[model samples]
Target: MRTFTVEIEKDEKFYIAQCVEHSNCFTQGKTIEEAIHNIKEVIDLILHIKRPKLHIILKDSLVNAL
Candidate 1:
């Protein structure tokens, strides 16, 4: 398992989350909760498809695997 930092921002109609470790990976939803769920799904898909290329960070700590 790998841990990555996810930054979430709220917009006018949606919440967006960007995974710091993965480029071109972002998730958006109607609500903050939905955005979090969507991001989790996106991260899982990314990890499955992209494997590993960048360093993962968690809570200001560098992580190899979650």
Candidate 2:
């Protein structure tokens, strides 16, 4: 698992959440909790779609064989 930093701030009507590691990733919600949840979902989606190039090994077996 990887960890990323998230910064949240309140605008005029919504709470905005942005990933410090990924400037292009951000989301907004009516409440701080909602904003955090939305940002988490967004990060998951972004990471899932743009997976890192690193490889994983388990019991000398390579996952994501490619």
Candidate 3:
């Protein structure tokens, strides 16, 4: 089993979670926890069906500089 890190972002309306190591896999929910859970489900589905090897670019800065 492989471990993937998921990055989550929340706005006023919804939360979006995406895997840092996988592109084209993402999920949205009403809250952070929900988003994380939904993203996990998406990951499982993708892995089970397609088993794709996703390569994502690493970003050094997570926040914008003001």
For candidate 3, lDDT tens digit of each residue in 1-66? 466777766556877778877788888899666876677688879866334333332233323311
Q: Give the better candidate number (1 or 3) by TM-score.
A: 3
How do all the candidates rank in terms of lDDT, highest first?
2, 3, 1
Residue pairs that clash (backbone atoms under 3 angstroms), model 1: 1-66
Please report how far candidate 1 places residue 34 from its true position, in Å: 0.7
Provide C-alpha RMSD values for all models, in order: 8.2, 14.3, 5.8
Mind sharing the TM-score for model 1? 0.66
Clashing pairs in 3: none
lDDT per residue (tens digit) for residues 1-66 in model 2: 566777776668887777877898789899767977787778778876332221211221212222
User: Which ranges in model 3 have alpha carbons more than 4 Å from their true place?
Assistant: 49-66
- Per-candidate Cα lDDT values, in order, are 0.63, 0.65, 0.65
User: How big is the positional error of residue 38 in model 3, measured in Å on the Cα after superposition?
Assistant: 0.3
lDDT value for candidate 2?
A: 0.65
Query: Which 10 consecutive positions of candidate 1 have the poorest summed lDDT?
Result: 56-65
Best by TM-score: 2
